[model samples]
Target: MSKLEIDFCGVKFRNPTVLASGVLGVTASSLKNVVKNGAGGVTTKSIWLKEHAGHKSPVMFGTDHYFMNAVGLSDAGIEKAEKETFPEYSKGGRPAPIIANIVAGKIADFGKLAERVSKLDPDIIEVNISCPNVEDELGKPFACSVVDAAAVTKLVRSKTKKPVIVKLSPNVSNIGEIAKACAGAGADGFCAINTVGPGMAIDINLRKSILSNRVGGLSGPAIKPVAVRCVYDIYKATGLPIIGTGGILTGEDAIEMMMAGARLVGMGTMVYYREVEGFGKVVSEMEEWCRKNGVKNVEEIVACIS
Candidate 1:
């Protein structure tokens, strides 16, 4: 465990592996299952201030090479999370940190929801300003603009004492600039390259768009290189710990991101690739890689890029 143990924003984790949001993180039981399967930390689905009715089904469609989803930030909402999910996740005072990933429709909603979700006593609060599916309300993902991104971070910062990590969108031209904006707004950390786009998959057979939303965020191995570059650029700009996400599938992929400056590596589409059990599989491979390389502390690799 020595190789896996690491400190992130003053919190301790049994390993560097974390469960990325929006992939089976809908409830306490779902997240608990992630922990049970061996993730060192877990992030809840991006919950909103109120129940959000998402886009119609066919909200997602994909191939083995990549994944596309327009989940529309659908969640059980903050009230239900506080009453049922958060309490259940923390019921036994578990040491593994639970980060409450929150989203909202308006600038004001960010602060309000952050305050409420922070009160649930999650170890950390993640502000999701990157979801591409919310453009109907937000015009575009907040993470796409420095001004909008900073505003959300500043507002959420004012509302919570817990560490606030801003999740960014890969659709932006320069995610590092957005990371800098969040850091300036007092973000304790950052999560990079939240799904890749507003892409469409057409069904030639049915003569229709594959997803109801027409376009969705692209994830999976297809985005790995881009996510790595985003993490590298952000580390250079902010020097803050990063929950590097996007297209991570193997222990090697996790190590690659760590070397690029991620203190914690997030696993999302990998769950789809390898199933929930992928958590343990990836962790074991990480340890095996460390043993082979004589790397005793995984943290030693963060920002080791030279």
Candidate 2:
């Protein structure tokens, strides 16, 4: 088999297929299932400093081409993560490489959450300053402002010994600039192109919105091109390792992401569109493509486009 192993900020992903945060990522049991089914890594759903009641239901809607939700970063909080998830995830013989995804309302809160979770020694710490749906409480996403992005990234990095990956928003006007700011703040890597939105769907018959939040992030195949472009731009600007996400439904889509400069490709909606084991199937297809194309080290393809 062609070698698919790639290292991102010192962590080795068995393959580039990672379970993106938010799909089946609430508890250890669910996360373990993805790892067992052959995900290279798994990110937990973004946890806030405290429990958050998210937006009212009718929170999701989807069709053949796209998926949307304003989950509002609803989470069980870090205490549960420390008590329930990480310990269980750490015990098993097949310990999944966990990337602890964290979100915050204040700049200092990012550091506090990182400090607390850093004790668990997760393989990585992903600061989610990019979540669009929580703007009502969190104000504008930190990702939209280079200064705020830097402050959050810097704070989180200062608090964690683990590799720090700053998740960037696709909603920004210049994602590359924000990425560069995060990089300067000592971000070890980036998770480019969080769901694209404030976009929406209509319920029509009810003469109302499909999702209760009215507007939500647009994900699935609809955002893949934008993801590829964001990854490509971030690579050109920062040259940082990246987990390219958004609309990765097939091995070909993942490969496209790699060529656009992703060291790892995140699979969320694909798991929904296919199944949890869909990660393994995607990796297999990637290897098959690599073999046919005479690609040896899969890393050779990263940023091949520019």
Candidate 3:
């Protein structure tokens, strides 16, 4: 059998295939189901300090090749995960290590949330600094500024002993500088890139935008190239462990991100389309490709572009 094991930021994963945070990770039942179906790791949906009902209906709209959603960081809150949900996973022989993704409106809130969730004993805490769907008076997403990204990450790092991975927004003009700033502030790793622009699609008939928020972050194959470039750039800049996500639908797609310097690859939009079992199929195909190329280990392919 092909060895898919990879060590990312001191945590060992059976393979590099992790389920990205979002709808796929909202509930414990769904997380167990995906683990049973074969994800190496699963990141919980982006939780906040308090519960959020999220946006109303029409938050998601489908396109021919991708999707746009403005979920507004709706989650069950960090305390629930720390006190109740995580215990369930701990009881069962967890199919894989869990990474908790979290977000907060204020910088200090990041530290408080991180401190609470750290007690849950997850393998990693992913600081969600790049959620483009939520907007304030800032004119751009919260993570669009390097200072905000670094400050939040720094505060969270001070509160947790666990590995801290900052997820970056692709909407930013200078992703590399933002990434370096996070690393300097004590982030152990990074996940690039979050969904692309807060793009809009209007309903010609209704004369209104499709999503409830009027604009939403885009994901799926349409944004893969942009994601790939972001990962490659950050990899070149920070040399930190990267979890690459965005537009990965097939084994080849996953491999593309790995070659762009992602230590681990996250599958999101594809899961919504193919369901959980699709992860196994992608792993199998990746194994075959590895054997054909005489690659003994998956890590050898990181940044191996010719």
lDDT string for model 3 (173-252, tens) is 88999999999999999998888888999999999888888888999889999999999989988999999999998888
Candidate lDDT scores, in order, read 0.89, 0.90, 0.86
TM-score of each: 0.98, 0.98, 0.96
Choose the strongest candidate by lDDT: 2
- For 45-109, candidate 1 gives per-residue lDDT tens digits of 88988888888998876688999998888876888898999888888886489988988878899
In candidate 3, how many Å is residue 38 off? 1.3
- Could you tell me the TM-score of candidate 1? 0.98
Residue clash pairs of candidate 3: none
CA lDDT of 244 in candidate 2?
95
Local accuracy of candidate 2 as per-residue lDDT tens digits, 32-94: 999888899999999888998889988776789999989888898999999998988887454
Worst 10 residues of 2 by lDDT: 88-97
Candidate 2, residue 158: how far the Cα is off, in Å: 1.3
Residues forming the 10-long window of minimal summed lDDT in candidate 3: 134-143
Which residue pairs collide in model 1, if any? none
Q: Which rank order by lDDT, best down to worst? A: 2, 1, 3
